[model samples]
Target: MGTLDEIKAALINLDIPQVQCKIHQGLAEGLSPSAILEKSLIAGMNTIGSRFKEGDFFMPEVLVAAKAMHTGLDILKPLLTAVENRVKGTVAIGTIKGDLHDIGKNLVIMMLEGAGFEVVDLGVDVPPDKFITAIETHHPRVVGLSVLLTSVMPQLQTTIQQLEPYRRELYIVIGGAPITQQYADKIGADGYAPDAASAVDKVRELIARN
Candidate 1:
């Protein structure tokens, strides 16, 4: 198999060491860093994401695959030229206040990064004002809110309301265990994702419309 294919397989298999080794080999074989990222690491993450969505893969598997992907990325990041480092867009993501869950949020961030978008992780228990600050400071094109608790679902609506002024400037995407398309629409969110994989697709679609 080609070095890129080998890298992808190793990553899918959660073979971190092999991922790192093949990435170095790809570099030695004159493969550009951007090629290694898009063709290998990102491609492998895409498969992992799909498997997770299909129920063939669980959180542990996805997490390990993400680690392998990040390992490959770490090797390539420094070698990428300025032009090759260009990102598709920026996304600021966080778990809504009163919701301490972050596994879903972290997964979404990983998928977004793998898809070539710069991610700003606002972490768990993020208040609406914090999200507002992220938007003001980072100027992201997309904002992601994650809520795992049914009781805290109201926080999502409150946060969106606080971000109303910036509504025209960015797209709001919401997700998590208790979140749904109906809830998103009711709360005036721009999009809804059922999982991390879908979040990347939704973000890409929202960005494309602008």
Candidate 2:
């Protein structure tokens, strides 16, 4: 197989050593850092997301693959000085208040970064004011809120209400264990994603309209 394809397969197989080796090999063979990242590493992660969605892979597999992707990214970081210029857009994401679960939120962040967006991780148990502060500071084109509990679902609506003033220029997307399109629509969210891969796609789609 080609060098990029080999790198992608190694990542999908969670072969961290092979991923690093291939990254170095790809670079030696005149491949650009950005090419290895977008074509191999990110493509492999996207496949992992699909496998998880299809039940062909689980958390352990996904996490290991993510680790391999990170290893590849670390190796490429120094050579990818111009990565900021390749950013599609900025997205600010946080888990809603009263919800400490960040597994899903973290996965979304990884996917966004892999998709070449500058992600501002707002972290867990984020209150509405914190999100407001982030909007003021980052001025991202899209905002994502995550909630893993049905009880904390109302916080999503509350946060969206607090962000209404910026609604004209910003798109709000919601997701998590208990979040659904119906809930998103009820809360007036601009978009909803069921998984990390979809979140990247949703954010990309939203950014295009901005």
Cα shift from native, residue 202, model 2 (Å): 2.3
What C-alpha lDDT values do all the predictions have?
A: 0.86, 0.87
Model 2 misplaced regions, further than 4 Å: 30-35, 50-58, 77-88
> What tens digits encode model 2's per-residue C-alpha lDDT throughout 38-106?
789877887887888899999899889878977887887656756555767789999999999887788
Q: Name the runs in model 1 displaced over 4 angstroms.
A: 27-39, 46-60, 79-88, 114-116, 195-198
lDDT minimum window of 10 residues, candidate 1: 76-85
User: What TM-score does model 1 achieve against the real structure?
Assistant: 0.77
- TM-score, candidate 2, is 0.80
TM-score of each: 0.77, 0.80
lDDT of 2 at 196: 78
Lowest-sum lDDT 10-residue window in model 2:
77-86
Per residue, candidate 1 scores C-alpha lDDT tens digits across 1-210 of: 999899999999989999998988888999877777778876787788788889999989988987786677666655653544669899999999998988778878866776678999999999999999999999999999999899999888899999999999999999997788998999999999987667888999999997
